[model samples]
Target: MKQGIHPDYHKVVFQDSSTGYKFMSSSTKGSDETIEWEDGNTYPLIRVEISSDSHPFYTGKQKFTQADGAVDRFNKKYGLSNN
Candidate 1:
């Protein structure tokens, strides 16, 4: 058990970088950024690349790659044809 050697665990805001969704949680992660939450209080801000808001699996927007012509892209890259 140590005292000063331990990092502080406190409330922080995790913002989805792509979607701008904010969520409150506690962590040992340190940040120099700050954000004002809906509760009218400021918390340490952490930017994340992805979260449940924009994830393909969670949003059911998962593309099988066939629906968006991604397969065609694959074919083009490998010198193949859709036909």
Candidate 2:
């Protein structure tokens, strides 16, 4: 518990630049831009490139690649078979 030594933590609005999705959360970061939140209050606006809304993983658009194991790769490289 220090006095005035920590950065100012306040509520800010984070907006996804690609999807225009916005959500409010607490952050130590500050911004000159402001936005009106759904709560009818004005807060600092922070723009982000990606969020849950536009993220491939969150949106279930991510590609899953199955990588071959070492043994499988070795077997494939040569003419070796399990039998």
Candidate 3:
């Protein structure tokens, strides 16, 4: 709704190589670690340890982690210690 400030739209390559591109699992055998890209194609290969495949939020398996000092800090800030 406001002018003079906005995010710049940049060109991003989603899937560069569909022919020679393959999703190789790190825990599988005969998987080539090196990806041989085509010539004259300037595409970046980013390494990801985990994606949405193993994410807890997408898989509906998220767990709540309870911290020690979290409850104490919340009670002190909200004056819940009087009760």
TM-score of each: 0.66, 0.81, 0.29
Look at candidate 3 and give me any clashing residue pairs: none
Candidate 1 C-alpha lDDT tens digits along 11-30: 99999999999899999996
| Rank ordering of all candidates by TM-score, starting from the highest | 2, 1, 3
- Candidate lDDT scores, in order, read 0.90, 0.94, 0.47
**Which residue pairs in model 2 clash with each other?**
none
- Give the poorly placed runs of model 3, Cα more than 4 Å off: 1-46, 65-73, 76-83
Tens-digit lDDT track of model 3 for 1-83: 58758654422222224232234332312222334344443333434545555557866899876775788889988888755
| Preferred candidate (TM-score higher): 2 or 3 | 2
Which residue runs does candidate 2 get wrong by more than 4 Å?
Answer: 69-83
Candidate 3, poorest ten consecutive residues by summed lDDT: 24-33
Better of 1 and 2 by lDDT: 2
Clash tally for model 3: 0
The 10-residue segment of model 1 with minimum total lDDT is 63-72
For model 1, the stretches where C-alpha displacement exceeds 4 angstroms are 1-7, 64-83
The best candidate by TM-score is 2
Better of 2 and 3 by lDDT: 2
